[model samples]
Target: MHYAVYFPLVFGAALGLLGPAAATRLPPRPATWLLTVGGLVAAGTTLLVLAILTATLIGGHSLLAGHLHWSPDVFDRSNPVPAVVGAAAALLLAVLAVRTAWAAVRSVVELRQAHRLARTLAPGDGELVVVTEPGPVALAVPGRPGRVVVSAELLRTFDAAERAVVLGHERSHLRHRHHLHHLAARVAAAAVPLLRGLPAATSLATERWADEDSTAQGPRPVVARALFEAAVRTRGAWPRRGACLSVASTDTDVRIRMMLAGPPRRRPLLLLTTVALLTLPVLAGGEALRDAHGLFREAALDAPMHSTPHPTSQR
Candidate 1:
């Protein structure tokens, strides 16, 4: 295989290293998009390289080559990947597939439960659903129309403007389908060990995106205050599961500071770098595919020569 196949691993590590900081510091919408896209590209490229390595190794074997009409001698002579490396790649790919499948299934089940809850909260009602509970709980439940569920007690605590901030934040989550962004990051992270931090970074970015959206309904300080209060109220609350959107899902301290800091500057350079990172792996994967094709073509061309018996052997 070509050396280019390994480039994605290095790029993935670099992206993982930069992901958290970029998710936190960049503009919320762009940051969410950058991290989500970066995670998918990195994870997908890693899988592609693994598949290529495994295929090359299998194709080089005599038994498989005979069935496939290729010359094992030619393929083995041309194959640059070590047997041990190929074996390890195959194992890793299998394990990642199992784990990713489990994660995806669990996420889907939880999302369905949230949708069910959304329907039960207020059937035939409009977009908003206010339920009475002792403690404060606010979340955006994704459904056909998307429902914003908030505890009645929570609403009573806020004045009209503060209420607007809370409603606006949750609405932003529904409006942009922020849960899907979080879901994609989560599934990708499950496959790539280097990307373990990616899900948290994505969650943080989504939260910030909602916070910024709330600014349209009220002042930044008001938005910050409302979120801070929600965090305090839900300090010891149970953690949210799946793609559910919550006001206090991430760190309130960082969000409060962000709101007080005014609007995030749009970083064109940072965006360009993110785009480049995503593009490089795809291009590298294409090159690796071309190399693999060449290896197989060369093996096929040598097959007939290998199969023909020498006159000396025929006697």
Candidate 2:
């Protein structure tokens, strides 16, 4: 196979390095979709390349070649993939499969728990549930009818405008289905170790998305102040259970600053370029597959035609 076969793996590592910073810089809504989808695509293409490499190892075996009517000698001579490299690829694929499966299971369990909690909180349509607590707490529970939960203590601390800001932020999470985006990022990270930063980046994007949404009605200062207060009030509060999304769950300081920085500028060029970069892995994978098929076809063509010996007449 051509050296391009390995490009997807290297590209994933490069994406991991750049993705987080890009997630913060871009507009939050687009950034959320880009990071989540990009991670999944990158992980998938990397797996494809690994599978191709693994196949080269097994397909090059003499016994397997005979069954497939392929010439092992020609295959070995033409194969660019080394035996050790193929072995390593196989091992990596197995490890990724186990990790991805475990991550997916955990995500599903957490989401189900969140849904149950939401159902318990509001049996009917979505509504706000205020719980009396010593400290501050707020979270959005996703379900058929999502519920927004807030602590009475936190409500008392916020003025009318800030209160609206907090509610709006959490509501945005439910409306946008941000939890699913997070789950996708989590599984992608598990499948591709190089993309370990993707989940955190997705978290930042979702939080920023909520923050931006909160500013729709009120001034930017109101949203910024509300976020700052939520972070301070819930500084030591225990995290919400399952996949319940909270207004102050991640990068509170950065989000507050971003809110104060004004709306993000529309940079179509950067967004388009990033999207184009995401497709490179998929293209590379296709190229690798084509090259591998050609290699095997050539081997099959070179296989010696053997005439079956006529069976002796039965006595």
Candidate 3:
């Protein structure tokens, strides 16, 4: 039982180490989905293992009262779990609880802040908002009736083709709800420190997704050039908002390189590999918990009886 509790953590660490390589091999859409889903599953399984460990500790303590006659001698046995291990599990569970709460509260606060900012943006025709700002700002703000905001400077800076590319990119983000995916990745990373890099990877992938989308509407070079020009023009000038998904959020150099290379081909093998990696740990954890439950049950049944009644003399 004690050893089983570590499986999820070990798997999470392994995924964290290997996930980047996997993401690189996959195309934008698959890569984004893979990272987001994998991070979520890893975090969820880690918490499940922690919960099982905590429950086992509580159950052991209750059973010990009957088995060892309320004596501290129960610690001498090492079948169910050692007292030292249980104590450590309790401490870890406490820390995880606090961390999870903090992450949830922080996510809520950021959402509220994003909504407030969205309210302040002046409405424009349809989903477009042309902010009268000097900076070359362009972003997709996600919410009910999501809006694509472009600054006055941005409109004036780009030509017709470039503007079309920009609109296509931001529209892709709004249509696909890329911000939700980003938010989920962020929350998962916050919950599981091992997956801290996941959010960044997903962000890059989302940028690529939008890039591909824009390319569908125009020449690849045109879209790539638009992204490069926007990135350069808006460098160090755009406002950082939690609620807005911007066209220039990812690494400009990487995006340029990917765009120049053209859209990636689908790699089914990579997807299969990623699926296997995610499934194995969950199955192992479930099997371990099943075995641990059986062991605990047997231990309970074998506990020493408090007293034995003398057999009555037979007639």
TM-score per model over all chains: 0.94, 0.93, 0.85
Please write out the lDDT profile of model 1 over residues 1-315, one tens digit for every residue: 668999888877887899999977799999999899988898888888888888877988888888888899899999899988889989999988787788788778887877877777788999998777668878888977789878888888999998898899999999999988988887888778888899999999999999999999888888889889987875544336566788888878998998999999988997887787789999999888889899999999889644577889986
- Looking at model 1, the pairs that clash are none
Residue 211 lDDT in candidate 2: 91
Report backbone clashes per prediction. Answer: 0, 0, 0
Clashing pairs in 3: none
RMSD of 2: 2.2
lDDT of each: 0.86, 0.88, 0.76
State how far residue 252 of model 2 sits from its true place (Å): 1.0
* Candidate 3: regions farther than 4 A off: 2-5, 62-80, 123-125, 299-315
Q: TM-score ranking from best to worst?
A: 1, 2, 3
Which residue pairs show collisions in model 2? none
Candidate with best lDDT: 2
Q: Is candidate 1 or candidate 3 better by lDDT?
A: 1
Query: How many steric clashes does model 2 contain?
Result: 0
- Per-residue lDDT tens digits for candidate 3, residues 1-315, read 546567788888877787666556689888888888888888788877776666556655655546544322332353466557657777877887787777777766766666666666654337788888877888887755777888888999889999999999999998988877788777777767888888788888888889999987688889899999987876666567765788778788888888888778788886887778888668867976886666555655566557756678433
Instruction: Please provide, for model 2 over 163-266, each residue's C-alpha lDDT reduced to its tens digit, 9 standing for 90 to 100.
Output: 99999998999999999999999999998998999999999999999999999859998789888888778765644765888876789988888888889877
